[model samples]
Target: MRHFSSSATRTSRHRVIGALTAALLCAAGATVPAAAHSPATPAPPAGAPAGSGLALTPPMGFNNWNSTHCRAEFNESMVKGIADIFVEKGLKEAGYEYVNLDDCWAKTQRNADGKLEADPVRFPNGIKAVADYVHSKGLKLGIYTSAGTRTCDSVGIPGALGHEFSDAQQFADWGVDYLKYDNCNNLGVDAKERYTTMRDALAATGRPIVYSICEWGENKPWEWAAELGNLWRTTGDINDSWNSMLSIMKQNLPLAAAAGPGHWNDPDMLEVGNGGMTDTEYRTHFSMWSVMAAPLLIGADLRKATPETFDILSNHEVIAVDQDPLGKQGTVLSSDGGRWVVAKEMQDGSRAVALFNETGSAQRISTTATEAGLPEATAYSVRDLWTHTTTNTAGGLSATVPAHGTVLLRVAADKHWAAYPPAVELALDGSALVEAGRTAKLTTRVTDLGRTPATKVSAALTGPAGWQVRADSATTAAALATGRTLATRWQVTAPAGTATGTYDLTLTTRYRAPSGKQVRSSVPFQAHVVVAPPAGGGYLSDLPRLSASNGYGPVEKDTSNGESAAGDGKPLTIGGQVFTKGLGAHASSSVEYYAGGACSTVTASVGVDDETGAKGSVAFEIWSDGTKAASTGVLTNDMAAQSVSADVSGAQVVRLVVTDGGDGVDYDHADWGDLRITC
Candidate 1:
C-alpha cells in the first residue's frame, strides 16, 4: 500500500509485518498517486490530480484471469495492447480503468534488497513503465499478490503473512497502484485476522494502496472485512458459466448490508469477459452484481473487447446504481428458491428494486406492495434499468419479473410506491421451535412499503394438529401492514405437558386494502418442539448432525426382506394387509432388519410401552422418488428401534410407514432428525 512521489527514486522493497499491527504510511505531499483502491493501483482520491474520471467510484475494467490469462504466447505487449486501445477508443472516458495483471505476473521473490518485482519474462519493461503508460492514458494500474505461502497458481514463494508492510513498500517502489492480496495456503484463527493483517500492512506502506483481500469467506470475513481492507472476497472463485455465477451471487446478496463505498464484497473478480457463458447470462451476471453492490472487478482480456461486453459494462443506468453516491449495498427483501426480490436505497431517497428469477424454468416474481417507514404517501416514476423505459401501471407499486432474468426499477416512493404501506413484517431469522413442554415467542414489526403508514389492520394465526392459541390478533384490528406490510405475530405456548413434535403454524394476513377486498395472505409458520426426552432421551444423543461439517454416508444393502418377527413387532401391515406383501416396490415384507442389534443395525426408539403389549416393535420402511429416499422406522418404548435395509433405491415406489408399535398412550412419538445412511 505504499506509493512514491513522481520525483522520488524507484526501488522495490518487501518486508514482513507482525500480525494485527497497524502500519501508518502515506506518500509525501498532496499528490496521492493512488486513489480509492479499485483492485487496480489504488486510485488517488477523486480530485487528487492523479486520478481519472470515476476515480472516486469503483473502477470498471477487465482482467485476464477469468477467461484467458497470459495464453497464446502473450506478454506485456498483450496487456499494453489492450490499454492502448482502451485509451485510443475512449474506453477510459466510458469509465473503464485499471488494466490489471492478475496472476503469473510476479517473480518468485524480491531481489537482494527485498524488493517485490514483476517477472522479467512477462512485463520486460517493468511494472513501473506499465503504470506510467496506464497513467498516460488517464487510467490506473493494478497488480496481484498472495496472502498464503503461495497463490492460486501454486508458485513456491513466500506470501504476505510475515512480510506485509515490506511488500507494501515494494509495490509503491514499483509504482504499483493496486494490490490484489490473495489467500492460497493461508491458516489463521480465521479469515478476519488474515485480512486484518494485510490491511494494516498496506497502510504501513504509507501509500494509498487498496488492499483487496481474497480469502473466499471461509469464515465469514465480510462480517468485519471492511475495517481491514477496501474489499474482501465473499465466495469461492466464479467461472464464466451461468450456474457458477448464479451460485456466487446467491450467497453474496444476503451480505450486501456489509458493503459500502470504500469497502466492498469482492465476488472473486468479474467473469463478464469470459466466453463460457452466453451474452445474456453475462448481462444477468453484471446486473445482479451491480444491484448487490459487489466489486465490479472485470475478469476478461480487455485487449480483445466485444461490443456486447461493452454494452453490458457501459449501461449508464446500471452503472449509476453501482456507483450511486449513496454507496449503499442492495439486499434481499424477499426470496424463494426460484425468484427473489432485492432492494437498495439510493441517494435521492429513491429505492431501486430488482425482481430476479434464477431458475432454468420460467418463473414469475411479483412485488405485491411494501413500506419504507415513510409518514405520507409518495409517488414514484418507475423506470426499468434494463429496458430503459417507464412502466405505465395503476397503483403505486409492484411488478412481475421474467424467468432467468430480472426486473430492476427505480421505485419512486412518491410516484408509484406512494399508495402502498408496509404490511407483512417477518422477524427473527426464521420460526422458533419450542421443545415439547416448552414455549416459543418472537417479536417483529411492520411498516408501509409506500408513503402511507399502516395505521390499523388485523392479523390472524392458525395452526395444524395441536396448537394452543394465546391471542386473536384480529380482535384489536391491530396494525395490519406497516409500510404496506402487516405488523403481526403468532405465538404458541405449549405447556411442559404439550406433545413433543413439529407443528406448522399458519399466519394469515387479513387487511382492508385500498381496493377493499380484505386480502388474506398466508405464510407458513413452522415450529419444532422436541419434548426433552423425559430425562435420558434420544437413541443416539451424542451422534453428530448430518451437516457440511459432518456428512453421513448412504444406507448399505445388508438386511433382510423377511417374514419373521425378528423386527419384534407383529407382522407389518402392507397395503392394508397383515401379510407383508406389496410393501415398497417389493413382492413382500416391511419386515425388521438388523444392523445395531447384538450389535444393532440402525436402531431407533419406538417410544411405545413394552409394558403391556405383545405387538410393540417399530419397523423400518421406505418410500423413494427416483433416488431420494424417505425412510421411516418406528420409535416406541417397547421395541426401541429396528433397522431394515430393504434396498430402497429408486425409492419412489416405497413408502416408509410406522404403526402399532406401542400400547395405547405408550408415548410412541417417533423422533428422528439425523437419519443418516452410512455407505
Candidate 2:
C-alpha cells in the first residue's frame, strides 16, 4: 500500500473550496479560462485548441457500478437487454447514453496483438456486436481496465500501460467509445505516470476514445485529470449504503470547477434500484449524483425494474440539470446535523438543489437561495422533482427550501442581476451603471448566510481579456473604504465585438483579521453577457428504475422469542425495497436476526393470536458486508395492515443474511430482497 504524502496539503485544509474552484472552472463547458485560473496552474497544452472548452459536450450515460451485476456471466442477450432497457426504460430519454461495463466483462487474457477480448461465453456474438447494439440505440459504449500492468484482480490482462497504442487500436477496432482506466496496482508517483502514459497512448489511436481514469483519489486527479482524461474517479468504490455514498460526496466539493463538458470526476456508480436501499434513500442518492454532475452508471437487474423505477429514471428536469451544457457540478455549500443543503447552478440561471436528511428522524432543513450564496434578486420557480410538482412558497420572488428532500428550483434574475458575497453587504453606487467610454466605478456587497454584513475586503482581478489595466497594481488590492466592504474603480474598456462574455476576475480578499484560522474567498467579476446561450443537459441514474419498499428504522421492538425475529406476520423493512421477513412465529415479542445471506428483504411483524398468546415483536435485519441492512424497534402491531414489511433492493457487496435467535418469538413471516449469490 503506497501512502500519500499528507505533509504537503496538511498546512492548507484541502477541504471544500478547492473542490468548488475545480467544479467552477470545468463548468465553463469547453472554454477553460486558463488566464483566469490561479497563476500556480501549469501552462495549457500546446497544439491543443487555445481556450477551446472540454472535448465532449453534455456528457451523457449511466455507469455500470450503479446497476452492475458482476461475477455472474452475462450473455449477448443480457448485454443487448441492457441497451433495450436503457432505451425502453427511458434512461436515454433522461439524456444518459453511456452503457459502461465496469471491472469484469473481459476474457482471461488478451491476444498477442494486445487486443483485449470479451468473454466469449458472455459475448457469443462478440464485443463489436455489443457496441453496435449500444450505438444503434444512440448510446455510446464504455469499457473498463486498470492502469497497472495487472489490475486489482491481480491477473487482469496487460492494459494500455506498456502497450498503449496497441490497446488503443484494439479498442478503436472494437468501436469502444470510452475507457474507464482504473488504478489498481501502481500507486504514488508511478500511478500518475501510468495514467498519463495511457492518456497519450489513447490519443495516438487517432480515434477519440473518451478517457476516464479511475484511480480512487490517490493523486489529486482534480489537479491533473482534466489534462489527461475526460473523467476520473475522485474516490474509491462506492457501495449501496448511505455512509459510503456520503463519504465520497463530501470529499469531492473542492473538485467541482474542474469538471466541464468533457472531463468529470466520477464518484463510483449509482446504487439506486439495486434492491438494498429504499426508494427514499435512492432519491437522495440520485439527487446527490446529479448535483455532483457525476456519471450515472446503474448496477442492478434492469430486467426486473418496476414502473415507478422507470419514472424516477426518466425525470427530464433532473436530467436537464445533470446535462446542463454549462456542465458545472454542484458542490456542498453547507452541511450540518445530519442535514445537508447542496446546490448546482443551471444553464438557465436556475439551480438544481437538494436538502438531504441522513439521519432516521424527519429533519427540517430550511434555506434561502441567498444563504447558499448564488446570484441574488433572481426569481426562482420551485419544482419538487420526486413529488413531480411545483413547491408553493410565500413568494416566487425567491426560494424557501424545506426538509427531508429537495425543492429543485429554477431562479433567474433579470439580465441586471448581480452576484453578491453572502457574508458581506455593500451599497453599490449605481452611477457605475453604463459609462459610454469611461470605466465605471464598481463596488462590492457581501453578507454571511445569516445576512450579517462583512467589510474591508481585498479584491483582485486578472487584467481584462482585451484591455491592460489603467492602474498598474498587483501588490495591493483595490481600496476598501471604512463602513464599506470592497471597492474598485476599473478604467476598463471593452474591445469592439468583444462578445461580452462573463469575465472571471479572481477577487481575492482578506476582509477581516483571523480569529482562529486564515480565511480567503474568490469572487468572479460579473457583467451582463451578450454571447451565445449556455449549454444544457443532465442525466438520471439506474436507481429510478427499481421499486424500493422499506426504509428500515430502529431495532429491538417487542417481545423476543429467540435471538432471531419471530413475528406473527410481516417483518421489518430497511432502506426501502429490502425487507427482513420472518419465517414463522409461534408467540413472542422481541426476535433477533443474525447477519447472513438472507438480509435482502428483512421484514418484521408482531401479532397476538387469541388461541396462541403471541404478543411480542419480530426484529430482523440484513447484515452483509459486516453491517446491518436495516434495523428497527420491535415490530409489534395489532392491525395486520400495519405489520412491518420491508423490501431491500441493493448492496452488492453485502447480501442480506439474517439469523433467527429462537427466543420466545417465532416470526410468522420474515424475508429479504436481492438475495446474495454465492458460488
Give the candidate number with the greatest lDDT: 1
Model 1, span 118-236: residue lDDT tens: 77888788888888887777776778877766555545555666677687777777666667777655654356666666666665555666567676665566776656666777765
Error of 2 at 455 (Å): 43
Candidate 2 C-alpha error for residue 55, in Å: 6.2
Writing each residue's lDDT as its tens digit, candidate 2 over 1-679 gives: 1111111111111211121111121111222111111212232353332112333443455555445445454456766788888888667665666777766577777777667788777777778888988888887787877665544442354545566667767777887777878665442337667777777666665555667777767667878767777777786566565544654665566578888876787777777677666666677777777778886666665787766566666666565566667678887766654457777876656666677654333333556666554455433334555544332222221221221244344433333122222232222222112212335344433222212233344545443566433433332333333233334445455454554333333345555421222335443333322221112201101011111111111122222112222232333332222223222222211122212222244343333222112333334453333245555444443324223333433322222222222332222222322222221
lDDT of 1 at 262: 71
Q: Find the candidate with the highest TM-score and give its number.
A: 1
RMSD from true fold, candidate 1: 18.6
| Local distance difference test, each candidate | 0.50, 0.48
